[model samples]
Target: MSSESSQLHIFFLPMLAHGHMLPMLDMANLVASRGVMATIVTTPLNVPLVSRTTSTPTSTKINILTIKFPAAEVGLPEECEILDSDNSKDTMPLFIKAVGMLQEQLEQLLSAYNPDCLVADTFFTWATDSAAKFNIPRLVFHSTGFFCLCASTCVGLYEPHRKVSSDSEPFVIPSLPGEIKLTRMLLPDLPKTDAEAAYIAKIVKTVNETEERSYGVVVKSFYELEKDYADYYRKVFGRKAWHIGPLSLCNRNSIEEKLQRGKASSIAENYCLEWLDSKKPASVVYVCFGSLTKFSDSQLREIAWGLEVSGQQFIWVVKKHENNAGEKEEWLPDGFEKRIEGRGLIIRGWAPQVLILDHEAVGGFVTHCGWNSTLEGVSAGVSLVTWPVAYEQIYTEKLVTDVLQIGVSVGVKKCDGLLGGSIKREAIEKAVNMIMVAGEAEEMRSRAKTFAKMAKEAVKEGGSSYSDLSALIQELSVRRLHH
Candidate 1:
């Protein structure tokens, strides 16, 4: 941003989910730090969640404006403001319907505030129409990278995956800038039943309609990370978009901010850091599937066995489950914790992921390949053991393992419907060894470090993402002037 204060007021509307909300807050913080007035529009219940994560100090003010989530109208409990992986399948339709119902309240807010621009999550398809009614530009916010967007566009346009005889057959996503091959299983599963299929079709239709009508997309990626796909998306796919991220970098300065980026950390920051400090440099493997994924007890056991057998120092973050019937012990082998006492740390809830990844003791990551995690790991320069569990994650896995060659796959060939299928101990152990200790580890780490440098540079002054953000603000400011 330039020295001059921006004459712009931007309203941000993120979906009621962790992955979507965190990045949007990061973007808000970034813009506010650059002298642009920002307001986050969210539901009542989400306010606390947002406030907790965005506690970092900033010079310029950022406001939080809440619209009551219509739980009664949507047939949900009043406290059901956020959705997660475990309950998403059952609750998504109701969740989306409730989001749709917020259109009027949002329009009312827009009319009263009259912000220059509205940057909203892709889930709010009606934002296009809402922004148009107020004659303001609405920039759609996508949490994924350019590669995933381009791949999705190609898949939708060409449907090449349909030509394959089996789910495992690799078919190229036609007309992309690079050769991106994926099996049908790697994509989001086809709607299983007719009602589910109809719901998906409705969402697809709305998303397509809104995207065409919106101003452009705001992607959480740096141009250098996926330059070819970024170009292809604009030129060939003809979508207007800007890459203004690795958004997580905004919280790079403070350990408090990093640890509290999404939810409150279950473990203390100093304890985690001190544990990392005890290890040898580049010797510990960090294993975390994203927030949304929940593995069965059997699957969890496999991971435990794999990490134990790998004989490597590791920190594993497990999703917190309310123990109605003692589920924790079901997943662990007898005396497992005692056996790995000195070498392993298991966090039962949120861990400060960025802080851990940035540590010198951490050399490798075992990730589910969600875009945020992928970019964070890349920025931290850690080689990965890719274990893609859900939609578009496999694409990211391919980017890391195939295109970028900075990671190795855990040989997970299929997605067994979101909660995730189990990978055997042997495959997990092998991938951990390959990325952390084996012959390929050095080369992978070097490549990852190169990308890490590029990521940091891209977010600094005069860099690609910085320039794009500046241009976006200038454009929006000019439009405000005209109005």
Candidate 2:
């Protein structure tokens, strides 16, 4: 390792959301551990969140730098956040606007540190331009898997998604190497209002421009998981994209432990982890819907009864905000908690998701199929019962369930807005039974376990992900010398 090839300093600017921020932070830790100087650019409000997951990086060459969030100025509450599940729909525009205001401070820091490369989130579409001003290489760290990336790109380019008559009308995307069929509903949301339409247009334009200016793209994925899509990203897109992931593997236990300690899970508080200890290995279902996915009261009751009917030992995490308008009692089925007292543990607020997923007692997951959760489950060797709640989650579910054949689809087709329609007990019980029960679901479990091994190996010294990460660092270092 020559000094010139390994001495690169990389600056990372992750988007404000937990899904985006946490993975990027894990990436920063990975980059730092790989012998590069990695600095994370964030707002003050989130600094504590990051700090808890990590120590003041002495062994790992990582640093967290913060800027003030203009919450009050932007008519947001003093505690405005990007990833907080409780955030209202109306605050999205304001959150974006507030984060955009950081560009000036970002520019100042870039000048001060003079890093070799600027690795930024996709949301900060202006970051590429800022890196250009400093004559630095801009590498976009997209917090998405390669499968989702390819699917989204193909759908956008082909526009076949628009030809569908309704949300359920599945159509094959006109021109893609892989077979991906999606409906209009699964496609990215089209603008409903004039202002929204304008914002959407501007975002599209900025993202396209950013892509053109980027030196390369870095993703939170591993080569083994989606080899075809990774190949397509490089050969078809004509871009340098590295898949260095199962990102949670970077000190997974430490981060998960810190997060678990930060908040006491509701009612059954510290009981979820302890309860898992009492169950048999690969015997419990860990049910969580990521940070988002607000289920309606009817949907909540359905899940309760479904879990009861499945007769599987489980740990179900329900967020506090899910109880609104003093309707907590009305949400669950009568005596749902009392009936499953010993069999099921209901955690109200945040739980250490990665921790629970990794537990020996956890055999299956009931998930919304968010990229992070998907990877966590994959890494943990846990079979999934997919119930995609929002965003490009349906696309993720397809990748996990259909393409990889490692999970069972619960067939939740329509997206759930805030308090949307119910996912009936039948759907829940069917999927859960498929994953938890024997005979028919063994293949799914075996495939998941196989992929989980690959996920762990991918981050080891000689793995594909390791090689890609090393190449990225070396490339940045060489560019530093030229600069």
Candidate 3:
């Protein structure tokens, strides 16, 4: 490639959530490491968070450009920050509209910079038209797993069959290319009310249209992890799709360096690491729901009691919210935290998730099955106690327990027709005891370790994911030069 072609300037726009922002940031870093110029486009409020994240990084190749949201009157937050709102009903519509308004600003930014191409989240389908107007090649970045993507597509294609009156009956999803079977219980709740359903339908249509126009889709996953689905997308979409993931593994060395520096703020990490250091290898269970998922007080109490009864060392990261107020002891079972005072640690806010999972003492994870958490757990060789909350997490739980067999689902009563059934304290305690004390625990640990090794190898030079990333860079660079 010519020098100019080799040094491409790429712009990335990710969704507002932490899960989306972090992966896109990682991808930008990887591209920058290859001598490409990476520019991140985010809302003004989110600018501070994004800026802070990039500040510690020594690399100066990546740049962040903040854009103002045009329609502030439409209930969107004035600042470019993520709203702490839990009500999806109040947020999703406004977020979709805001993305539309942001397109005008994005168009102007593109005209000024004239970057080679634009890489954006799947949600920002409006960028397709804007990219075309600016004569820039666009690549849609799917933050979720390929399996969930397949499931969502199935919901879109088979719209008629998916519209069940209640969340009770299980419906089989068609056109799944993998050996896995997807039932309605595992699918995401596609906006049940008419207004919500309409909004979802529009989003689905936009995704399909955007995919048709883009150069390709870039997924943060590897071929070995979703071979059949990857192949299926290639055949059906007739567009180039590449798997370059566990992006965490790509920058493991840098992350380790960050940890070694001990520069991470206590506010951001919430001191979960100090607690893990006190536990034995393969002894502590790490529990964390991802950024979006939240729980009711009843559910929270059950989990606390379950942990207490399990009689194992555990570390739980609970985000402080409006609902969870009373004293910590009041929420937990009697003498729970006191009984395991030396063994249990409860963090009230953002925990150093990646670092905590990487710890040798963390034998098992109690997760909501978010893809990022799933990848981190598997990469760390930690077994899972799946407790999916919402969205595509149920599907992810299936992927972990049924497809991979690296983890077990806790309190999921499939035969009872309960979709992601609620777990009582006893159920939680029993599951943990089985996973930690039974002879099966050691076997699960060995399997988790093996999976973690595979994740590491996939990102190493000459590995499947590493080579796929190289090919993607080469292809995009070529497209940039020609366009």
CA lDDT, every model vs. true structure: 0.88, 0.79, 0.73
- What would the per-residue lDDT of candidate 1 be over residues 1-483, giving only the tens digit for each residue? 444344578999999988889899999989988878889999887888788766686425679999989978878877888887556668777988898989999999999998999999998999999999999899999979988888877787788977999988989888886687788877876677999978877878789789978999999999988898899888886888889999999888877778768877898889999999999999999999887888888899999999999999999988857567745578888889999998999998787899999999999999999999999999999999999887778788878988889999998878775577879999999999999879979999999999999999999999999999999988888887888
TM-score for every candidate vs. truth? 0.96, 0.92, 0.89
Count of clashes, each model: 0, 0, 4
Better of 2 and 3 by TM-score: 2
Please give the lDDT score for candidate 1: 0.88
**Pairs clashing in candidate 1?**
none
Q: List runs of model 1 lying over 4 Å from the truth.
A: 1-6, 193-199, 324-328
Which 10 consecutive residues of model 3 have the lowest summed lDDT? 257-266
Root-mean-square deviation (CA) per prediction: 2.1, 2.9, 3.7
Model 2: number of backbone collisions: 0
- TM-score between candidate 2 and the true structure: 0.92
Best-to-worst ranking by TM-score: 1, 2, 3
Query: What is the model-wide C-alpha lDDT for candidate 3?
Result: 0.73
